[model samples]
Target: MMPRRLILAGAVALGAAAAFAAFQPSPVAAREAVVYKNPQCGCCKGWATYLQRNGYKVTVIDVEDIEGIKRRLQVPDNLHSCHTAMIDGYVVEGHVPVEAIDKLLTKRPNFTGIASPGMPSGSPGMDGPKEDNVVKAFGPGGIRVFGTY
Candidate 1:
Protein backbone atom coordinates (compact mmCIF):
# COMPACT_ATOMS: atom_id res chain seq x y z
CA MET A 1 0.00 0.00 0.00
CA MET A 2 1.11 3.59 -0.63
CA PRO A 3 2.48 5.47 2.40
CA ARG A 4 -0.11 7.71 4.10
CA ARG A 5 2.05 10.80 3.55
CA LEU A 6 2.44 10.03 -0.14
CA ILE A 7 -1.31 9.60 -0.55
CA LEU A 8 -1.99 12.97 1.04
CA ALA A 9 0.63 14.68 -1.09
CA GLY A 10 -0.78 13.14 -4.26
CA ALA A 11 -4.27 14.32 -3.42
CA VAL A 12 -3.08 17.86 -2.85
CA ALA A 13 -1.26 17.90 -6.17
CA LEU A 14 -4.36 16.66 -7.98
CA GLY A 15 -6.55 19.30 -6.40
CA ALA A 16 -4.12 22.05 -7.34
CA ALA A 17 -4.02 20.90 -10.93
CA ALA A 18 -7.82 20.88 -11.17
CA ALA A 19 -8.11 24.40 -9.79
CA PHE A 20 -5.48 25.75 -12.19
CA ALA A 21 -7.21 24.18 -15.15
CA ALA A 22 -10.53 25.77 -14.16
CA PHE A 23 -9.06 29.26 -14.25
CA GLN A 24 -7.40 28.85 -17.62
CA PRO A 25 -9.39 29.75 -20.70
CA SER A 26 -11.52 26.99 -22.16
CA PRO A 27 -10.58 25.07 -25.33
CA VAL A 28 -9.17 27.62 -27.76
CA ALA A 29 -10.34 25.82 -30.88
CA ALA A 30 -13.89 26.29 -29.68
CA ARG A 31 -13.40 30.02 -29.11
CA GLU A 32 -13.26 31.32 -32.65
CA ALA A 33 -14.58 34.89 -32.79
CA VAL A 34 -15.32 36.61 -36.08
CA VAL A 35 -15.48 40.40 -35.89
CA TYR A 36 -17.17 42.55 -38.54
CA LYS A 37 -16.62 46.28 -38.80
CA ASN A 38 -16.52 49.17 -41.24
CA PRO A 39 -13.27 49.49 -43.19
CA GLN A 40 -12.57 52.87 -41.60
CA CYS A 41 -13.13 51.82 -37.98
CA GLY A 42 -9.98 51.69 -35.82
CA CYS A 43 -11.83 51.17 -32.55
CA CYS A 44 -13.19 47.95 -33.94
CA LYS A 45 -9.63 46.78 -34.50
CA GLY A 46 -8.76 47.61 -30.93
CA TRP A 47 -11.69 45.53 -29.71
CA ALA A 48 -10.54 42.59 -31.79
CA THR A 49 -7.05 42.89 -30.37
CA TYR A 50 -8.44 42.76 -26.86
CA LEU A 51 -10.35 39.60 -27.66
CA GLN A 52 -7.19 38.03 -29.05
CA ARG A 53 -5.35 38.81 -25.84
CA ASN A 54 -8.11 37.06 -23.90
CA GLY A 55 -7.70 33.76 -25.80
CA TYR A 56 -10.15 34.18 -28.63
CA LYS A 57 -9.05 33.21 -32.14
CA VAL A 58 -10.19 36.45 -33.75
CA THR A 59 -10.78 36.96 -37.47
CA VAL A 60 -11.69 40.49 -38.53
CA ILE A 61 -13.55 41.36 -41.71
CA ASP A 62 -13.93 44.94 -42.84
CA VAL A 63 -17.11 45.65 -44.70
CA GLU A 64 -18.45 48.81 -46.33
CA ASP A 65 -21.87 48.75 -44.70
CA ILE A 66 -21.48 47.63 -41.09
CA GLU A 67 -25.18 48.24 -40.60
CA GLY A 68 -25.93 45.55 -43.14
CA ILE A 69 -24.12 42.95 -41.07
CA LYS A 70 -25.87 44.14 -37.91
CA ARG A 71 -29.22 43.87 -39.56
CA ARG A 72 -28.43 40.46 -40.98
CA LEU A 73 -27.42 39.28 -37.53
CA GLN A 74 -30.75 40.55 -36.18
CA VAL A 75 -29.09 42.76 -33.58
CA PRO A 76 -31.40 45.32 -32.04
CA ASP A 77 -31.04 48.94 -33.17
CA ASN A 78 -30.69 50.11 -29.59
CA LEU A 79 -27.88 47.65 -28.91
CA HIS A 80 -25.85 48.70 -31.92
CA SER A 81 -22.17 49.37 -31.65
CA CYS A 82 -19.20 50.18 -33.91
CA HIS A 83 -18.26 46.51 -34.28
CA THR A 84 -19.96 43.14 -34.08
CA ALA A 85 -18.63 39.66 -33.42
CA MET A 86 -19.88 36.12 -33.70
CA ILE A 87 -18.70 33.44 -31.33
CA ASP A 88 -20.03 29.96 -30.82
CA GLY A 89 -23.24 30.85 -32.64
CA TYR A 90 -23.91 33.95 -30.49
CA VAL A 91 -23.57 37.56 -31.47
CA VAL A 92 -21.43 39.85 -29.32
CA GLU A 93 -21.94 43.54 -29.97
CA GLY A 94 -19.70 46.39 -28.86
CA HIS A 95 -16.81 46.36 -26.41
CA VAL A 96 -18.25 43.70 -24.13
CA PRO A 97 -15.95 42.45 -21.40
CA VAL A 98 -14.47 38.98 -21.43
CA GLU A 99 -16.26 38.18 -18.16
CA ALA A 100 -19.63 38.66 -19.78
CA ILE A 101 -18.52 36.69 -22.82
CA ASP A 102 -17.46 33.84 -20.56
CA LYS A 103 -20.83 33.90 -18.84
CA LEU A 104 -22.69 33.91 -22.14
CA LEU A 105 -20.72 30.93 -23.41
CA THR A 106 -21.13 29.04 -20.16
CA LYS A 107 -24.86 29.64 -19.78
CA ARG A 108 -25.70 29.25 -23.49
CA PRO A 109 -28.77 31.38 -22.90
CA ASN A 110 -31.46 31.48 -25.53
CA PHE A 111 -31.00 34.94 -26.98
CA THR A 112 -30.05 36.75 -30.13
CA GLY A 113 -26.84 37.95 -28.45
CA ILE A 114 -25.23 40.17 -25.82
CA ALA A 115 -24.13 43.77 -26.19
CA SER A 116 -22.39 46.60 -24.37
CA PRO A 117 -24.47 48.87 -26.58
CA GLY A 118 -23.19 51.92 -28.41
CA MET A 119 -19.59 53.09 -28.38
CA PRO A 120 -19.36 53.49 -24.66
CA SER A 121 -16.25 55.09 -23.18
CA GLY A 122 -13.69 52.74 -21.61
CA SER A 123 -14.99 49.77 -23.52
CA PRO A 124 -12.21 47.45 -24.71
CA GLY A 125 -11.81 49.32 -28.00
CA MET A 126 -12.44 52.85 -26.78
CA ASP A 127 -10.04 55.30 -25.19
CA GLY A 128 -10.35 56.65 -21.64
CA PRO A 129 -10.28 55.08 -18.21
CA LYS A 130 -12.26 51.96 -17.44
CA GLU A 131 -15.90 52.79 -16.87
CA ASP A 132 -18.87 50.85 -15.58
CA ASN A 133 -20.74 49.33 -18.50
CA VAL A 134 -24.21 47.90 -18.54
CA VAL A 135 -24.20 44.75 -20.65
CA LYS A 136 -27.55 43.58 -21.96
CA ALA A 137 -28.94 40.41 -23.49
CA PHE A 138 -31.46 40.94 -26.26
CA GLY A 139 -33.59 38.47 -28.15
CA PRO A 140 -37.17 37.65 -29.05
CA GLY A 141 -38.00 37.76 -25.35
CA GLY A 142 -36.72 41.36 -25.14
CA ILE A 143 -33.74 43.06 -23.57
CA ARG A 144 -32.58 42.59 -19.98
CA VAL A 145 -29.46 43.33 -17.99
CA PHE A 146 -26.97 40.47 -18.21
CA GLY A 147 -24.22 42.00 -16.12
CA THR A 148 -22.52 45.27 -15.18
CA TYR A 149 -18.81 46.03 -15.29
Candidate 2:
Protein backbone atom coordinates (compact mmCIF):
# COMPACT_ATOMS: atom_id res chain seq x y z
CA MET A 1 0.00 0.00 0.00
CA MET A 2 1.10 3.62 -0.64
CA PRO A 3 2.17 5.78 2.31
CA ARG A 4 0.06 8.83 3.29
CA ARG A 5 2.98 11.27 2.84
CA LEU A 6 3.74 9.90 -0.64
CA ILE A 7 0.10 10.24 -1.69
CA LEU A 8 -0.02 13.83 -0.41
CA ALA A 9 3.18 14.75 -2.32
CA GLY A 10 1.84 13.25 -5.56
CA ALA A 11 -1.41 15.14 -5.18
CA VAL A 12 0.44 18.43 -4.64
CA ALA A 13 2.63 17.81 -7.67
CA LEU A 14 -0.37 17.03 -9.86
CA GLY A 15 -2.18 20.16 -8.69
CA ALA A 16 0.86 22.32 -9.41
CA ALA A 17 1.24 20.79 -12.88
CA ALA A 18 -2.39 21.45 -13.63
CA ALA A 19 -2.04 25.08 -12.56
CA PHE A 20 1.02 25.52 -14.73
CA ALA A 21 -0.72 23.96 -17.69
CA ALA A 22 -3.72 26.24 -17.21
CA PHE A 23 -1.48 29.33 -17.22
CA GLN A 24 0.49 28.29 -20.29
CA PRO A 25 0.84 30.78 -23.14
CA SER A 26 -1.81 30.72 -25.83
CA PRO A 27 -0.86 29.17 -29.19
CA VAL A 28 -3.27 31.45 -31.02
CA ALA A 29 -1.81 34.33 -33.04
CA ALA A 30 -3.11 37.90 -33.40
CA ARG A 31 -5.39 38.78 -36.26
CA GLU A 32 -4.60 41.19 -39.12
CA ALA A 33 -5.77 44.85 -39.05
CA VAL A 34 -6.52 47.76 -41.38
CA VAL A 35 -5.53 51.42 -40.87
CA TYR A 36 -6.79 54.59 -42.57
CA LYS A 37 -4.82 57.81 -42.75
CA ASN A 38 -4.56 61.08 -44.65
CA PRO A 39 -2.61 60.67 -47.86
CA GLN A 40 -0.14 63.46 -47.13
CA CYS A 41 0.83 62.41 -43.59
CA GLY A 42 4.18 60.63 -43.34
CA CYS A 43 3.74 60.04 -39.63
CA CYS A 44 0.76 57.80 -40.31
CA LYS A 45 2.96 55.72 -42.55
CA GLY A 46 5.52 55.45 -39.79
CA TRP A 47 2.80 54.26 -37.43
CA ALA A 48 1.77 51.59 -39.88
CA THR A 49 5.40 50.43 -40.03
CA TYR A 50 5.47 50.26 -36.26
CA LEU A 51 2.44 47.97 -36.18
CA GLN A 52 3.99 45.76 -38.85
CA ARG A 53 7.18 45.40 -36.82
CA ASN A 54 5.14 44.18 -33.87
CA GLY A 55 3.50 41.16 -35.63
CA TYR A 56 0.37 42.85 -36.94
CA LYS A 57 -0.77 42.50 -40.52
CA VAL A 58 -1.56 46.17 -41.27
CA THR A 59 -3.29 47.55 -44.34
CA VAL A 60 -2.90 51.29 -44.83
CA ILE A 61 -5.39 53.42 -46.72
CA ASP A 62 -4.61 57.05 -47.43
CA VAL A 63 -7.70 59.19 -47.89
CA GLU A 64 -8.07 62.77 -49.07
CA ASP A 65 -10.58 63.55 -46.33
CA ILE A 66 -10.39 61.76 -42.98
CA GLU A 67 -13.67 63.22 -41.73
CA GLY A 68 -15.64 61.21 -44.24
CA ILE A 69 -14.06 58.04 -42.91
CA LYS A 70 -14.53 59.20 -39.33
CA ARG A 71 -18.20 60.00 -39.88
CA ARG A 72 -18.72 56.68 -41.55
CA LEU A 73 -17.19 54.82 -38.63
CA GLN A 74 -18.94 57.07 -36.05
CA VAL A 75 -15.58 58.08 -34.52
CA PRO A 76 -16.02 60.86 -32.03
CA ASP A 77 -14.20 64.19 -32.51
CA ASN A 78 -12.32 63.98 -29.21
CA LEU A 79 -10.79 60.62 -30.10
CA HIS A 80 -9.55 61.81 -33.45
CA SER A 81 -5.91 61.24 -34.37
CA CYS A 82 -3.53 61.10 -37.32
CA HIS A 83 -4.69 57.63 -38.29
CA THR A 84 -7.47 55.15 -37.62
CA ALA A 85 -7.72 51.39 -37.78
CA MET A 86 -10.17 48.53 -37.42
CA ILE A 87 -9.17 45.29 -35.75
CA ASP A 88 -11.55 42.56 -34.68
CA GLY A 89 -14.51 44.97 -34.97
CA TYR A 90 -12.96 47.81 -32.90
CA VAL A 91 -11.49 51.13 -33.97
CA VAL A 92 -7.89 52.04 -33.12
CA GLU A 93 -6.97 55.71 -33.45
CA GLY A 94 -3.65 57.51 -33.56
CA HIS A 95 -0.65 56.18 -31.62
CA VAL A 96 -2.38 53.64 -29.36
CA PRO A 97 0.10 50.96 -28.20
CA VAL A 98 0.23 47.50 -29.69
CA GLU A 99 -0.44 46.02 -26.24
CA ALA A 100 -3.56 48.15 -25.80
CA ILE A 101 -4.69 47.23 -29.27
CA ASP A 102 -4.10 43.62 -28.37
CA LYS A 103 -6.18 44.05 -25.25
CA LEU A 104 -8.94 45.75 -27.25
CA LEU A 105 -8.99 42.79 -29.56
CA THR A 106 -8.98 40.37 -26.64
CA LYS A 107 -11.53 42.13 -24.44
CA ARG A 108 -13.73 43.27 -27.35
CA PRO A 109 -14.99 46.50 -25.80
CA ASN A 110 -18.60 47.38 -26.71
CA PHE A 111 -18.01 50.94 -27.90
CA THR A 112 -16.61 53.08 -30.71
CA GLY A 113 -12.88 52.27 -30.09
CA ILE A 114 -9.54 53.54 -28.76
CA ALA A 115 -7.69 56.73 -29.64
CA SER A 116 -4.56 58.71 -28.70
CA PRO A 117 -5.79 62.15 -29.68
CA GLY A 118 -3.32 64.51 -31.47
CA MET A 119 0.29 63.57 -32.11
CA PRO A 120 1.77 62.93 -28.69
CA SER A 121 5.57 62.80 -28.71
CA GLY A 122 5.86 59.47 -26.86
CA SER A 123 3.08 57.63 -28.63
CA PRO A 124 3.68 54.44 -30.61
CA GLY A 125 4.53 56.00 -33.98
CA MET A 126 5.66 59.24 -32.35
CA ASP A 127 7.97 57.40 -29.94
CA GLY A 128 10.61 59.48 -28.21
CA PRO A 129 12.38 59.80 -24.85
CA LYS A 130 10.23 62.82 -24.00
CA GLU A 131 7.61 62.74 -21.26
CA ASP A 132 5.14 65.17 -22.87
CA ASN A 133 2.96 62.47 -24.38
CA VAL A 134 -0.53 61.45 -23.30
CA VAL A 135 -2.89 58.79 -24.68
CA LYS A 136 -6.65 58.54 -24.20
CA ALA A 137 -9.26 55.98 -25.21
CA PHE A 138 -12.57 57.44 -26.37
CA GLY A 139 -15.99 56.44 -27.56
CA PRO A 140 -19.18 58.17 -28.73
CA GLY A 141 -19.86 58.90 -25.05
CA GLY A 142 -16.56 60.04 -23.47
CA ILE A 143 -12.91 59.32 -22.74
CA ARG A 144 -11.16 56.59 -20.75
CA VAL A 145 -7.68 56.15 -19.32
CA PHE A 146 -5.36 54.60 -21.83
CA GLY A 147 -1.80 55.24 -20.60
CA THR A 148 0.92 57.93 -20.28
CA TYR A 149 3.89 56.05 -21.66
Candidate 3:
Protein backbone atom coordinates (compact mmCIF):
# COMPACT_ATOMS: atom_id res chain seq x y z
CA MET A 1 0.00 0.00 0.00
CA MET A 2 1.18 3.57 -0.67
CA PRO A 3 2.24 5.48 2.46
CA ARG A 4 0.21 8.57 3.55
CA ARG A 5 3.20 10.89 2.84
CA LEU A 6 3.59 9.42 -0.67
CA ILE A 7 -0.12 9.91 -1.37
CA LEU A 8 0.08 13.55 -0.13
CA ALA A 9 3.11 14.23 -2.36
CA GLY A 10 1.32 12.83 -5.41
CA ALA A 11 -1.74 14.95 -4.70
CA VAL A 12 0.42 18.06 -4.38
CA ALA A 13 2.17 17.28 -7.65
CA LEU A 14 -1.16 16.81 -9.42
CA GLY A 15 -2.47 20.10 -7.96
CA ALA A 16 0.63 21.94 -9.14
CA ALA A 17 0.31 20.47 -12.61
CA ALA A 18 -3.33 21.43 -12.80
CA ALA A 19 -2.58 24.94 -11.66
CA PHE A 20 0.12 25.32 -14.29
CA ALA A 21 -2.18 24.12 -17.00
CA ALA A 22 -4.93 26.49 -15.92
CA PHE A 23 -2.61 29.48 -15.96
CA GLN A 24 -1.21 28.77 -19.39
CA PRO A 25 -2.41 31.31 -21.90
CA SER A 26 -4.37 30.10 -24.88
CA PRO A 27 -3.28 30.95 -28.42
CA VAL A 28 -5.13 33.84 -30.02
CA ALA A 29 -6.63 33.57 -33.49
CA ALA A 30 -5.33 35.94 -36.17
CA ARG A 31 -7.91 38.32 -37.65
CA GLU A 32 -8.34 38.78 -41.40
CA ALA A 33 -9.05 42.14 -43.03
CA VAL A 34 -9.89 43.14 -46.59
CA VAL A 35 -9.33 46.79 -47.52
CA TYR A 36 -10.75 48.46 -50.60
CA LYS A 37 -9.16 51.69 -51.72
CA ASN A 38 -8.44 53.79 -54.78
CA PRO A 39 -5.56 52.54 -56.89
CA GLN A 40 -3.60 55.78 -56.49
CA CYS A 41 -4.07 56.21 -52.74
CA GLY A 42 -0.95 56.08 -50.58
CA CYS A 43 -2.63 56.67 -47.23
CA CYS A 44 -4.75 53.60 -47.82
CA LYS A 45 -1.60 51.52 -48.06
CA GLY A 46 -0.37 53.14 -44.90
CA TRP A 47 -3.55 52.11 -43.10
CA ALA A 48 -3.16 48.52 -44.32
CA THR A 49 0.40 48.50 -42.98
CA TYR A 50 -0.87 49.74 -39.63
CA LEU A 51 -3.40 46.92 -39.43
CA GLN A 52 -0.75 44.36 -40.34
CA ARG A 53 1.49 45.69 -37.61
CA ASN A 54 -1.37 45.15 -35.16
CA GLY A 55 -1.60 41.42 -35.95
CA TYR A 56 -4.23 41.70 -38.65
CA LYS A 57 -3.92 39.74 -41.90
CA VAL A 58 -4.55 42.53 -44.40
CA THR A 59 -5.56 42.04 -48.04
CA VAL A 60 -5.71 45.28 -49.99
CA ILE A 61 -7.76 45.52 -53.17
CA ASP A 62 -7.17 48.66 -55.21
CA VAL A 63 -10.27 49.62 -57.12
CA GLU A 64 -10.91 52.42 -59.55
CA ASP A 65 -14.23 53.29 -57.93
CA ILE A 66 -13.99 53.38 -54.12
CA GLU A 67 -17.16 55.39 -53.75
CA GLY A 68 -19.14 52.60 -55.34
CA ILE A 69 -17.74 50.10 -52.88
CA LYS A 70 -18.68 52.30 -49.96
CA ARG A 71 -22.15 52.77 -51.38
CA ARG A 72 -22.60 49.03 -51.77
CA LEU A 73 -21.37 48.48 -48.21
CA GLN A 74 -24.12 50.86 -47.06
CA VAL A 75 -21.67 53.15 -45.31
CA PRO A 76 -23.26 56.48 -44.56
CA ASP A 77 -22.14 59.29 -46.88
CA ASN A 78 -21.28 61.49 -43.89
CA LEU A 79 -18.89 58.78 -42.67
CA HIS A 80 -17.01 58.55 -45.95
CA SER A 81 -13.26 58.41 -45.81
CA CYS A 82 -10.27 57.67 -48.06
CA HIS A 83 -10.49 53.88 -47.67
CA THR A 84 -12.78 51.13 -46.43
CA ALA A 85 -11.93 47.85 -44.75
CA MET A 86 -13.94 44.73 -43.95
CA ILE A 87 -12.92 42.69 -40.91
CA ASP A 88 -14.93 39.94 -39.20
CA GLY A 89 -18.08 41.30 -40.85
CA TYR A 90 -17.36 44.85 -39.69
CA VAL A 91 -16.71 47.75 -41.99
CA VAL A 92 -13.84 49.95 -40.89
CA GLU A 93 -13.62 53.25 -42.79
CA GLY A 94 -11.05 56.04 -42.92
CA HIS A 95 -7.89 56.20 -40.78
CA VAL A 96 -9.16 54.40 -37.70
CA PRO A 97 -6.68 53.44 -35.01
CA VAL A 98 -5.97 49.94 -33.75
CA GLU A 99 -7.29 50.57 -30.25
CA ALA A 100 -10.71 51.46 -31.64
CA ILE A 101 -10.67 48.30 -33.68
CA ASP A 102 -9.84 46.26 -30.60
CA LYS A 103 -12.70 47.79 -28.69
CA LEU A 104 -15.12 47.24 -31.55
CA LEU A 105 -14.15 43.61 -31.77
CA THR A 106 -14.43 43.10 -28.02
CA LYS A 107 -17.78 44.81 -27.59
CA ARG A 108 -19.26 43.23 -30.69
CA PRO A 109 -21.78 45.98 -30.90
CA ASN A 110 -24.84 45.69 -33.10
CA PHE A 111 -23.53 48.17 -35.63
CA THR A 112 -22.81 47.80 -39.31
CA GLY A 113 -19.29 49.19 -38.83
CA ILE A 114 -17.13 52.02 -37.56
CA ALA A 115 -15.77 55.08 -39.41
CA SER A 116 -13.22 57.74 -38.67
CA PRO A 117 -14.82 60.15 -41.13
CA GLY A 118 -12.27 62.39 -42.90
CA MET A 119 -8.58 61.59 -42.92
CA PRO A 120 -7.54 63.34 -39.73
CA SER A 121 -3.87 63.96 -39.11
CA GLY A 122 -2.18 61.66 -36.52
CA SER A 123 -4.59 58.85 -37.15
CA PRO A 124 -3.32 55.30 -37.74
CA GLY A 125 -1.84 56.16 -41.16
CA MET A 126 -2.29 59.86 -41.74
CA ASP A 127 0.72 62.18 -41.31
CA GLY A 128 1.07 64.87 -38.65
CA PRO A 129 0.39 64.82 -34.90
CA LYS A 130 -2.35 62.43 -33.79
CA GLU A 131 -5.07 64.39 -32.05
CA ASP A 132 -8.82 64.27 -31.57
CA ASN A 133 -8.93 60.92 -33.34
CA VAL A 134 -12.62 60.19 -33.04
CA VAL A 135 -14.40 57.20 -34.62
CA LYS A 136 -18.12 56.60 -35.01
CA ALA A 137 -20.25 53.46 -35.47
CA PHE A 138 -23.11 53.51 -37.98
CA GLY A 139 -25.90 50.98 -38.38
CA PRO A 140 -29.69 50.78 -38.46
CA GLY A 141 -29.60 52.60 -35.11
CA GLY A 142 -27.72 55.57 -36.61
CA ILE A 143 -24.24 56.94 -35.86
CA ARG A 144 -22.65 57.11 -32.43
CA VAL A 145 -19.21 57.49 -30.89
CA PHE A 146 -17.08 54.36 -31.29
CA GLY A 147 -13.70 55.29 -29.88
CA THR A 148 -11.07 58.05 -29.59
CA TYR A 149 -7.32 57.91 -30.04
Candidate 4:
Protein backbone atom coordinates (compact mmCIF):
# COMPACT_ATOMS: atom_id res chain seq x y z
CA MET A 1 0.00 0.00 0.00
CA MET A 2 1.18 3.56 -0.78
CA PRO A 3 1.95 5.91 2.15
CA ARG A 4 -0.52 8.78 2.80
CA ARG A 5 2.03 11.44 1.78
CA LEU A 6 2.74 9.65 -1.52
CA ILE A 7 -0.98 9.46 -2.34
CA LEU A 8 -1.48 13.13 -1.37
CA ALA A 9 1.46 14.23 -3.48
CA GLY A 10 0.22 12.29 -6.49
CA ALA A 11 -3.22 13.87 -6.15
CA VAL A 12 -1.71 17.36 -5.99
CA ALA A 13 0.38 16.73 -9.07
CA LEU A 14 -2.57 15.38 -11.00
CA GLY A 15 -4.67 18.37 -10.00
CA ALA A 16 -1.99 20.77 -11.08
CA ALA A 17 -1.70 19.09 -14.49
CA ALA A 18 -5.48 19.28 -14.99
CA ALA A 19 -5.50 22.94 -14.00
CA PHE A 20 -2.69 23.72 -16.41
CA ALA A 21 -4.45 21.93 -19.24
CA ALA A 22 -7.70 23.73 -18.55
CA PHE A 23 -5.97 27.09 -18.80
CA GLN A 24 -4.05 26.24 -21.95
CA PRO A 25 -5.02 28.19 -25.06
CA SER A 26 -6.62 26.41 -27.97
CA PRO A 27 -4.83 26.01 -31.27
CA VAL A 28 -5.38 28.74 -33.85
CA ALA A 29 -7.45 28.01 -36.94
CA ALA A 30 -5.78 27.53 -40.31
CA ARG A 31 -5.43 30.60 -42.53
CA GLU A 32 -7.89 30.81 -45.42
CA ALA A 33 -6.60 31.22 -49.00
CA VAL A 34 -8.71 31.79 -52.09
CA VAL A 35 -6.82 30.95 -55.28
CA TYR A 36 -7.95 31.87 -58.75
CA LYS A 37 -6.34 29.85 -61.51
CA ASN A 38 -6.86 29.02 -65.13
CA PRO A 39 -8.65 25.69 -65.55
CA GLN A 40 -5.82 24.22 -67.60
CA CYS A 41 -2.92 25.52 -65.51
CA GLY A 42 -1.44 22.59 -63.63
CA CYS A 43 1.26 24.67 -61.95
CA CYS A 44 -1.41 26.78 -60.30
CA LYS A 45 -3.03 23.68 -58.88
CA GLY A 46 0.35 22.63 -57.54
CA TRP A 47 0.69 25.99 -55.83
CA ALA A 48 -2.68 25.52 -54.15
CA THR A 49 -1.60 22.11 -52.96
CA TYR A 50 1.60 23.57 -51.57
CA LEU A 51 -0.40 26.13 -49.59
CA GLN A 52 -2.65 23.41 -48.21
CA ARG A 53 0.37 21.36 -47.18
CA ASN A 54 1.61 24.43 -45.34
CA GLY A 55 -1.63 24.76 -43.27
CA TYR A 56 -3.64 27.11 -45.50
CA LYS A 57 -7.33 26.37 -45.96
CA VAL A 58 -7.38 26.81 -49.74
CA THR A 59 -10.27 27.38 -52.14
CA VAL A 60 -9.42 27.25 -55.82
CA ILE A 61 -11.61 28.80 -58.49
CA ASP A 62 -11.16 27.90 -62.13
CA VAL A 63 -11.54 31.04 -64.17
CA GLU A 64 -10.87 31.46 -67.85
CA ASP A 65 -10.08 35.15 -67.44
CA ILE A 66 -7.07 34.82 -65.20
CA GLU A 67 -5.59 38.01 -66.59
CA GLY A 68 -8.80 39.81 -65.74
CA ILE A 69 -8.53 38.58 -62.18
CA LYS A 70 -4.95 39.77 -62.00
CA ARG A 71 -5.96 43.15 -63.26
CA ARG A 72 -8.77 43.33 -60.74
CA LEU A 73 -6.34 42.44 -57.99
CA GLN A 74 -4.12 45.33 -59.18
CA VAL A 75 -1.29 42.97 -60.11
CA PRO A 76 0.98 44.94 -62.38
CA ASP A 77 1.70 43.51 -65.81
CA ASN A 78 5.22 42.68 -64.70
CA LEU A 79 3.98 40.88 -61.58
CA HIS A 80 1.52 38.62 -63.37
CA SER A 81 1.60 34.93 -62.69
CA CYS A 82 -0.43 31.85 -63.62
CA HIS A 83 -2.57 32.08 -60.53
CA THR A 84 -3.75 34.75 -58.12
CA ALA A 85 -4.51 34.38 -54.44
CA MET A 86 -6.16 36.54 -51.81
CA ILE A 87 -5.26 35.98 -48.19
CA ASP A 88 -6.36 38.16 -45.33
CA GLY A 89 -6.96 41.07 -47.75
CA TYR A 90 -3.58 40.79 -49.51
CA VAL A 91 -2.89 39.53 -52.97
CA VAL A 92 -0.28 36.81 -53.40
CA GLU A 93 0.78 36.26 -56.98
CA GLY A 94 2.68 33.40 -58.56
CA HIS A 95 4.55 30.75 -56.58
CA VAL A 96 5.32 32.50 -53.32
CA PRO A 97 7.16 30.56 -50.68
CA VAL A 98 5.49 29.74 -47.35
CA GLU A 99 8.12 31.71 -45.46
CA ALA A 100 7.39 34.85 -47.49
CA ILE A 101 3.68 34.38 -47.02
CA ASP A 102 4.11 34.06 -43.25
CA LYS A 103 6.24 37.16 -43.16
CA LEU A 104 3.64 39.11 -45.15
CA LEU A 105 0.93 38.18 -42.71
CA THR A 106 2.99 38.86 -39.61
CA LYS A 107 4.10 42.24 -40.85
CA ARG A 108 1.16 43.89 -42.57
CA PRO A 109 2.75 46.58 -44.70
CA ASN A 110 1.29 49.37 -46.79
CA PHE A 111 1.27 47.74 -50.18
CA THR A 112 -1.11 46.09 -52.61
CA GLY A 113 0.53 42.75 -51.97
CA ILE A 114 3.63 40.65 -52.66
CA ALA A 115 4.43 38.68 -55.76
CA SER A 116 7.09 36.32 -57.03
CA PRO A 117 6.46 37.89 -60.44
CA GLY A 118 7.01 35.39 -63.23
CA MET A 119 6.78 31.68 -62.44
CA PRO A 120 10.46 31.00 -62.04
CA SER A 121 11.60 27.42 -62.22
CA GLY A 122 11.94 25.69 -58.83
CA SER A 123 9.42 27.92 -57.10
CA PRO A 124 7.03 26.41 -54.59
CA GLY A 125 4.75 24.99 -57.30
CA MET A 126 6.89 24.77 -60.41
CA ASP A 127 9.31 21.88 -60.58
CA GLY A 128 12.99 22.22 -61.37
CA PRO A 129 16.25 22.63 -59.55
CA LYS A 130 15.75 25.20 -56.79
CA GLU A 131 16.39 28.75 -57.92
CA ASP A 132 16.85 32.00 -56.04
CA ASN A 133 13.29 33.40 -56.02
CA VAL A 134 12.71 37.12 -56.26
CA VAL A 135 9.68 38.37 -54.36
CA LYS A 136 8.56 41.97 -54.58
CA ALA A 137 6.00 44.21 -52.93
CA PHE A 138 3.93 46.44 -55.21
CA GLY A 139 1.23 49.04 -54.92
CA PRO A 140 0.24 52.38 -56.42
CA GLY A 141 3.34 53.63 -54.66
CA GLY A 142 5.45 51.32 -56.90
CA ILE A 143 7.48 48.15 -56.48
CA ARG A 144 10.02 47.39 -53.81
CA VAL A 145 12.18 44.28 -53.84
CA PHE A 146 10.82 42.36 -50.89
CA GLY A 147 13.42 39.63 -50.65
CA THR A 148 15.31 36.89 -52.41
CA TYR A 149 14.95 33.31 -51.24
Name the best candidate (by TM-score): 4
Worst 10 residues of 1 by lDDT: 23-32
lDDT of 2 by residue, 31-145 (tens): 6789899988888888888888998888888888888888788778877888888887888878887887877777776667877778877667775665544566666567777
Residue-wise C-alpha lDDT for candidate 1, range 1-149, written one tens digit per residue: 99999999999999999999999875655489999998899999999999998988999999998899999999999999899999999999999999999999999999989999887788888998878899999998999999998
User: Which ten contiguous residues of candidate 4 have the minimum total lDDT?
Assistant: 23-32
Native-to-model Cα distance after best TM-score fit, residue 22 in candidate 2, in Å:
24
Compared with the true structure, all predictions reach lDDT values of 0.92, 0.79, 0.93, 0.93
TM-score of each: 0.80, 0.73, 0.82, 0.83
lDDT of 4: 0.93
The number of clashing residue pairs in each candidate reads 0, 0, 1, 0
Which residue pairs collide in model 1, if any?
A: none
Which regions in candidate 2 have their CA more than 4 angstroms from the true location? 1-26
Ranking by lDDT: 4, 3, 1, 2
Q: Candidate 3, 137: how far from true, in Å?
A: 0.6
- What is candidate 4's lDDT per residue for 44-76, written digit by digit as tens? 999999999999999999999999999989999
What RMSD does each model have against the real structure? 6.4, 6.6, 4.3, 2.8
